[model samples]
Every structure is written in C-alpha cells, then in structure tokens.
Target: MTTPYLLILLVIGLGAGVSSGIFGIGGGILIVPALMYWAKFSQHAAVGTSLAILLPPVGLAAVTEYYRSGNVDLKVAGIVAAGVLVGGWLGASIANQLNGHTLKLVFGLFVLLMGAYLTASAARAI
Candidate 1:
C-alpha cells in the first residue's frame, strides 16, 4: 500500500485498538466510522473490512491486560465468543437482505440509542 493509505490505516488501527481496550469495542465503534469517513469506503465495505479484523486481532491487548488484573473469566468468555460467532453469522445473513438505506437507518438508530444511554449513565454517575 501507499504511504498515505498506510498512515490512514495506522490511525484507524490505533483508534480501534485503544477504544477496544478501553470500551470493549473496536471494529463497529471506531474502525467502521473511520473506514467510512476517512477511507471513503461504502458502508457495506466498511462493515466487511471491520468484520475481517475481528479474528486477526484476537483481543490480545485487552485480553492480556484484563488477564493480568484478574478480570478475565476465560471459560465464560469462550462461551460468549461462541455465541458471538453464531450471532454474527445470523446478523450478517439478515443484514445482507436489507437495502443500504434501511440498514444504515437501523444501524444509526442503534448507535444513537447506545450513545444516549452511555451518556446518561455517565452523567448520572458524576
């Protein structure tokens, strides 16, 4: 890849990595938006690329830190991962059937709701 493209990827990975480690999210939260806006990818392309990163990342950074702090429950996590695998397949199957506009609308609404909930919860704690 070209230097500029590489740099964009580096920034995206950095953002995704930090956000993943901190907030238990990376691809959907950071990478998707970064890919869509900065990389000028279509929403479907962004989603596909973000999904591709899931297995490769292996949750190493966040998992290691959580493991060190004794916050990990490996058995439980493994079980959850299994569920996520199944759910991802199911979700993709459904998502593929939807038109771009409808998919974007639903995805946006979900993000907005989550953002609002998180904001409200944080405010309550402050």
Candidate 2:
C-alpha cells in the first residue's frame, strides 16, 4: 500500500479505537463508514472488514480498563456475546445477498434513524 493509504488506515483505527473506548461503539458506528468513505470500500466490504478488525481480542485493553473500574459485567457480556454470534451470522448472510447500492441505502437509513432517535432521547434528558 502507498504511504497515504497506510496513513488513512492508521487514522481510521485510531478513530475507531478512541470512539469505542469512550462510547462502547465503533465497528458499525465508525469503522464501517470510515472504511467505505476513506478507503473506497463497498458497503459489504466495509462491513466485513470492520468485523475482521473487531475480533473479540481487539477490545481486551478497553475491557480490562472497564473491568478495573467495575464497569464490566462478565455474565451479561457472555450472554450478549452468545446472541451476537448468532445474530452476526444471520446478518452477514442477509448482507451478502444484497447489492451494494441497496446495502448502502439500508445502512444510511439505519444510521439516520438511530441518530434521530438518540438525539431526541438525549434532548428529553436535557
């Protein structure tokens, strides 16, 4: 890869890691879009790449810190992880059957709706 491409990847990883540490979100919320926009990846490619980068061990450092702070619930996390394994397979199966444009449209709409929901919810709290 060219130096610029490598730099872009570094930035993407840094952004995802920082966001994940702070918000408990990164793979879908940050890395997928970053890969698609900055790295010229297709929606499917971006999703797959994000999943690859987010293998369980990747978050060990953050998890360790959270555990240290008593913010980690092993039981809850284990249960959710089991669901994730099944859901991830199902989601990937569905995604693979979608065309790039359709997948991107769906992804964009999901993000838009989520942003609106979160914004409204936060506004209510404030």
lDDT of 2 at 44: 93
Per-residue lDDT value at 61 in model 2: 82
lDDT of 1: 0.87
Candidate 2: worst-modelled 10 consecutive residues by lDDT: 53-62
Residues 1-126 of candidate 1 have per-residue lDDT tens digits of 889999999999998888888878888878988888898887788888899986677577678888999999999999999999899999989888888778778888989999999999999999
lDDT winner:
2
lDDT of 2 by residue, 14-112 (tens): 998988899988999999999998999989999999999989745588899999999989999999999999999999999999999999999989999
Q: Give me the runs in candidate 1 sitting further than 4 Å from their true place.
A: none
Number of clashes in model 1?
0
RMSD of model 1, in Å?
1.4
Candidate 2 residue pairs that clash:
none
